[model samples]
Target: MSALSQLDRGVAPIETGMLPRPFVVRSRREELADCVTLELAALDGEPLAFEAGQFTMLYVHGIGEVAISISGDTAKPDSLIQTVRAVGAVSQAICGLAEGARVGVRGPLGNSWPVERAVGKHLMIVAGGLGLAPVRPIIYWALANRDRLKSVDIVYGTRAPDQILFARQLLGLSAADGVRVGITVDLADQDWSGQVGVVTDLIPSMLRDPDETVAMVCGPEIMMRFSGQALVGAGVPAEETFLSMERNMKCGIGWCGHCQLGPHLICRDGPVFAYPAVRDLMSVWEL
Candidate 1:
């Protein structure tokens, strides 16, 4: 392996150029039943370069900071796309904000998915619940560079059929050539005809050369643990599997203690980590 690849084999390098700034909410749209997609423009109307799979700390004037994943690409730096679910006090407050409202933003933080590493390799993305937000950018990146990569597969699971975010967009991508997208719901309705089990159940159906494929996963810890096991069982190497984890992150930077997991800090060392790096901590209750 090359020297840079050798260095990055265990962990991704720390990225630069992301810092806090004030931004304005240019627009907001309801993406799904309870999810809202916010479009943020810089206070001076400039652009911010961000990588796919990275997240930011969104600061509501009086509410507080909440960690959100970047769903847009660096190509369109003038605006940012953040999809949030109204689940907590701060999230509900954010959902209530209107367009033209001003908010504080503190990053394009965290490590991004290894897009370059995934080139020419079969890429498998598994997302569950609101986990789709973190991985959404990679999907767009892959679609834009379809020829450079091999097969692109996405398997997502939601709480219910109505709770599926980016449903139309994903379905359209799945219909296109060289892409496979499967969806599952915990509980199905009469209208639902897709997979009806956990997201792990769909893994076996999408076959690829495990040694030559890279799997990226984001979701609940339990879901990630099970999915990691499934991928290993399907012959994918443990190091080739990456995971985006969610901890109670107070500071998007590493200062706060809320997001720590053992020697690693979810906000700093990861929000995205290789399966082997975090597999041990998955069993620990609080770190």
Candidate 2:
């Protein structure tokens, strides 16, 4: 019998971060050469509720587990969605899973973006590369709550045209009322004619009133740092700007020290933080 089956049936089981819930891969879509977006459904038929900026520890059976951000609409709780980039052993295993494969999930862990704070203000979502996946839920939230928000502006930058994730979806979002989307790339091919520069370069044109804008940025550490600087320089308050920091998180819980940045644990204290909270540490080389 399994270890779980041998446990005393008379006693109540304690919930822990290490215990994984079962989920089945309902569908998977290739977003880029190395990334795939998986739509998961709980085997128990219950919903996996999650906030916009939270991530989950996805376990690939005997392979291992990796923390991945939720990329689906928050309002739709019945289905769990995660975008996985095949960068490591576990993620590679996950990306290779077929439909109907069973996977283990540990959480909707970590804190979330303060999107509600921008209810009455302009919501500016800035992302670079795959960073867009982590912040896509905010876009869904903004679109749904458009009447409550002053404006919704999204600025995205990727290394090249082909590297863009959710390209067609972003195109559709651009046409939404009260929403504006700006896209840029570091390099362009013959078919590309959009802006050719870093995402920070597009900040000026997207910002209508810095004082009234709340910026949420996620990308590589270097990209997020520069984006924060650009937003602050454009007159947005440092506290009004938030960033999602990706680190070497071994455990979704704080038991592991791998995700520590100074006094904060990226997995526990935040993957999402006010720009001012991590600005200094982000500048440190290899810290």
Give me the candidate number with maximum TM-score. Answer: 2
Worst 10 residues of 1 by lDDT: 10-19
Top of the candidates by lDDT: 2
Candidates in order, TM-scores: namely 0.91, 0.95
Superposed by TM-score, candidate 2 places the C-alpha of residue 36 at a distance from the truth, in angstroms, of 0.2
The TM-score of predicted model 1 comes to 0.91
Q: How many residue pairs clash per model?
A: 0, 0
Candidate 1 lDDT tens digits, 1-287: 54345445653333322235778888998988678999999896667788988888888877887898988765787889899888998888777779988887877788889877789898999999889988988888888888988889999988889988887887777546678998999999999888898999999888578888899999988999999999988999899899998887876667657888888888878888999998888978764
Query: By TM-score, how accurate is candidate 2?
Result: 0.95
Candidate 2 yields a Cα-based lDDT of: 0.92
Task: Go through the candidates in order and give each one's C-alpha lDDT.
Answer: 0.84, 0.92
1-287 per-residue lDDT for model 2 (tens digits)? 33244344433322546678999999999999999999999999989999999999999989998999999999999989999999989999999999999999988999999999999999999999999999999999998999999999999999999999999999777554678999999999999989999999999999999999999999999999999999999999999999999887787778768999999999989999999899999999999
* Candidate 1, residue 270: lDDT: 82
